[model samples]
Target: REVELRLEQANHARQEAAAALGAVMERRRMLEDRLRVVRGELQSTVVRPVDPAHVMRLQVIEDQSVQALKVVRTHLGTLRDRQRALRREAGDAGARLATARTRLEELRNAAEIARQEISAVAVEIAELRVRGESVAEGLRRDADASVEEALEVPRPDVDEDLESLLASHEAELRRLGPVNPLAAQEYRDLQERYDFLAAQLDDLSSSRAELRKVIAALDERIVEEFTAAFQEVARYFEEYFGVLFPGGKGRLRLVDGSDPLTSGVEVEAMPLGKKVSRLSLLSGGERSLAALAFLFSVFRARPGPFYVLDEVEAALDDANLRRFLRLVDRFRERAQLLIVTHQQQTMEVADILYGVTLERGGSSQVLSRRIRERSQPA
Candidate 1:
């Protein structure tokens, strides 16, 4: 019985050992999977071994870089301060230059006034010299002798006091009347002003001549352009008018044939069986058609990328509307046309349609639809 109990205990211990071994095997498998995932990640990553010497070197480099950054910041601040100082110096220089210019102008004005005064004094001196010469000539003529003898009269022995001499000079000055001291200066000023005005007048006269020539040239150019355009549009107008109203004669006449620049235009339209001297004499539809013909004639003469016509054919009848639509058809391949109208016939000929409609909530919405191509009459 003792041996059996010992054998049973041995068997239980072997079973526990087997279970532990299985658990260890499972744990090894999980570890192997985790290792494989880590190896894959390690293959993609770049790993460098960290050395104490390299770490120390990088720390030194960072310190140097911080120092260099500080130096550069200091240099930048110094440069900014220099720039501000330079700007201030430049401003001071500009102010000094302006003040110098103002002072120079004032000096120039003073010099001009001084020069004018000097000229007036010189003129007065010349007049006095001329009078002295005339008096000397008169004395020579009256004495009937040489000029030396005429002035050789000896003075009597008398005491000519300084006060008496000054009084006599003052009395002579008083007899000369109110002498204008600024007469010569005023004359110089007037002369300069007259010269300036004369120059201005000459410039004005030349400008007037140039302006007249320009006007003549412009008038000529206008006549040439107007004549050529009128002839081309008139031809197109005749062609379109015949198309709109078969067997009708239409013409555009200038009210003043002599001058196309300032002339008004008159439209004469004669329908197939009627004679109309003026546009107003035609019926409403006929008048609209005639106007469209003229407008399209102008369009033909001057081609453009697109055209906008707002209710142009609103007064046209069905027959005239067809003619107008046919006219619009001729320009479709060359340009885009935007027509605003309530006519279904007009919309039927369009390549696109845009309409505004109200939704159930009373909000407005814009809708766009492309139209199908329709066969056009040649």
Candidate 2:
């Protein structure tokens, strides 16, 4: 039945493959006809005059038709190969089905023979079980007689020599001590200590690994945050520095290259033509301006509630002094900027001011002043 079923499935598959092959062949024929027509059209001259553009268009159409024909032929060849393979597979499957049917018939005949043999063996087993106790006693006597005959047989002389050698080996083993009375307790104590030490070592190793992992995670977080802040600050620093010195450039970089977590940063600035490598290299006014730029850069990157600057623009010239006031004005829009400057430009931009003055007694007094604005005409 299984062989028949396989044969039926094989036939169905062959029919399906044949149908598909016919469809593929029909499609291939149609494509070939279309391609032939296109090539004939390309070779034929039109009644109108031929120009370069017309020739080019015909060339393109011919090329496309040739490509399409090659694709169709390639698919046709693939289908032919597939059809051949399917025919071969169907033939092989038929042969296998025939062989399997023969094998099944043989197995069925063998099963019939085995059934008869099993029935006979079952009857024989039942008859043997029904035999009386006398038969059992007779079987026991026969077994005893066989055992006695086996015992009566003499063994070879080499066996005694082997037995003596075995005795000598036993004597040699006995010469080594049977037990170590005191050593046992010492061994127990040593084993206990070893187990305790091993367990403690394992626990310590795991704890150390966990600690290292935690340290690595923390270090990674710190580096990520620091790098992000550094980039933002560097960008703002360049902007502020450019505004402070219109034609110059400034850069902020880490002093240490390899490790950002344990590194210091330095600023390099060039004002129009002067290259200032260090903060100390600048004049007092330039130094003040650079410091203020750096501070505002940090503030722009990470804004705060308020800021307090005490005469920070005191050393700047009128030009840089105006630039400084611009930065102050911009920052005041985003934060509460408190300036204690003696510069008139700083005072001019101030929305409100709290003036601090010293009394003769050496104590400082704080006073608040709201600058009144001029009213607009309606």
Candidate 3:
């Protein structure tokens, strides 16, 4: 009975130790997994505190602890792989960051240089403007003084000298009047001849005065007509430019010469939102369009019987050519348009097409054809 009781107690003790060992093995496994996770997080820049107390708290049988240590060793392998990948990424990012920082410094230096250059240019421009104003003022003062001097100079009196000579001749003739009988007859004949000559001269003077008045009236009429026509042409120019540039605008002013007899008209073309003067400052196509607009405006105002346009669309593009054709169609009511162009669009709008062909013999011949179909004679 005593031996059986001792055997039963030893069996219970062995079973309890085995159960405790199993529990300790499970805890050791959990700690190994936690260590692997922490090591991985640390490689990825995640901070983790080491728990020596938790590792010491793990109570396992000797063999179980040995097996848990083997599991922890496997974590080192994965941790090494993670560390390698993280190091490569960090190295590439550092290189990129260094390049970006260098570029930022260079841009800052360039911006500072540009700012200094702009400040210097602004100072120079201000000084030049002031000097230019002073020079212009000095020139104007000199011009004024020269004009005053010219006005104060004396001039010869041609009309007064002629009147004095004529009066002296009349006095001499009167003094020799009614002397002797034969002398008086001769004197009377001479006086009659002189009176006839004087009457003829007076008629000539009156005729000259009338001619001068007629010329003055004609000049005034011509000036009025040209001024009105010029204004109308300017209005057409404005409309045409507005159509071409859409939202943009332009102005056409007629500049007159200083001398009336030698005076001529000049076109002052000013584009909207531009500071430059003259059409020459524009691009090639723009200059062509501006010239075309001016010519069209003149034609609209004057309205010739027929126009002779010679290759005027050479510089125009497809879009601009369309606009030009539209303008021509609008003007067709006022005048007949005869456009010469090699473009298909211009050929399409022709009423009577004339083709100039060079034959094999090198001679050019004009071939005229009516574009519209004609009905056959019945």
| Consecutive 10-residue window with the lowest summed lDDT within model 1 | 42-51
Q: What is the TM-score of each candidate against the true structure?
A: 0.50, 0.48, 0.44
lDDT of 3 by residue, 209-249 (tens): 44345434534543464456557867987887766655456
lDDT of 2 by residue, 1-378 (tens): 443444455445445544554554555456556545644543332212212233234234434544554554454555455455545545555565556546555555554554565555555545544542335455558765454454444644654654555555455445543434454354345335334433433443353344345434544654575577678878998999988878888878887757764555677877878866676687777766776676677667766566666666776789888888777766666767666667777777776767888999999999876675423100
Model 1 lDDT, residue 194, Cα:
38
lDDT of 3: 0.52
Query: In candidate 2, which residue ranges exceed 4 Å CA deviation?
Result: 1-182, 262-264, 273-280, 357-365, 372-378
lDDT score of residue 169 within candidate 2: 47
Residue 180, candidate 3: alpha-carbon lDDT: 38
Model 1 CA RMSD to the hidden true structure, in angstroms? 43.1
What lDDT score goes with residue 42 in model 3? 20
TM-score for candidate 2, please give it: 0.48
Query: 1 or 3, which is superior by lDDT?
Result: 1
